[model samples]
Target: MNLRQKIATGAITLCSSTLVLFLGTWEGNGQNTVYADKLARGLPTVCKGITKHTSPDPVVVGDYWSDERCAEVEHLVIEKGQLALADCLTNQAIEQNTFDALTSHGHNFGMPSTCASRAVGLINAGRIADGCRALAKAPDGSPVWSYVTDAQGKKKFVPGLYARRLKEAELCAK
Candidate 1:
């Protein structure tokens, strides 16, 4: 090859290598990435103790989670929850508090459900206060009637869930 062509090729290779190295280092550090405190608070409350898997279908429960495992799972959930919220927003800019609240709600309720909720509808329609209020309501659009059948088929109100919904609503309002 000609000298000029060889020099250009070398330059291109160097630039590409530098870019790859920079990205790899940045991603490896993970120090700059900041997850929302509200999300962190809400996730552990709803999911309870940590297990290897996040899905409830398999029903894998464990008494303890290593600190590293917990951190990894939290990061994974936050990443997924953020994507879900972003997709639901569809280019709409929202306050950080609202985003964090909705992200947590979505993480708990499943993103599709949250996306299709009346709260989201109201928010999209420019009724922010109404949307926040709607978020505090039960999934069926009723007041927080926090009751569910236990394993023995008895009903009970879960105070934790009720409080979480209230907190989410408050965050949304902010």
Candidate 2:
């Protein structure tokens, strides 16, 4: 209509366009969106390329965080394939390592007597990550488990149950 009104409208349009472009490019950058769905609130955000270990979230059930970067590492395992990733994820339990939480569960549940078989059957064949991603994030938009953040940050587990699983996967190349 008027010159002033037209100019203001044009300015608004330009600003909106720029904002949309900036946000699109910034999406998922330096962030781990793979497990964003599994992240918990009050915990840190999972980025794509910045794994750091500096959060207060504890690993628990419904926690994608295992004090081990299972989620992040899982991607590699998955890309490698089901059978191989299963071997990697369950290596600790198979060895009867006390650190593997799954081992205890496996012994009690009688899934397969060996953690490796159980892991392979459940994760590779059954697709545990698919299920986990749905329920791992917090209500406040943070990670449920601290490990997811750590995984996103590229932190590895020490030489223990979790570490063993990851190491096994890395060694297996699957």
**Candidate 2: TM-score?**
0.18
Model 1 gets an lDDT of 0.52
Task: Give TM-scores for every candidate, taking all chains together and pairing residue i with residue i.
Answer: 0.58, 0.18
List ranges where model 1 is wrong by over 4 Å.
1-59, 138-156
lDDT of each: 0.52, 0.30
List all candidate RMSDs to the true structure.
14.1, 21.9
**Which runs of model 2 end up more than 4 angstroms from their true locations?**
1-27, 30-38, 49-86, 89-119, 122-174
Name the TM-score of candidate 1: 0.58
lDDT of 1 by residue, 1-174 (tens): 432233345421212332223322322232222222232232223122222234332222222434454445555555555555665663243555666666666655667878888888888777777788787784566655234456566766666656667777887788
> Would you give me the overall lDDT of model 2?
0.30
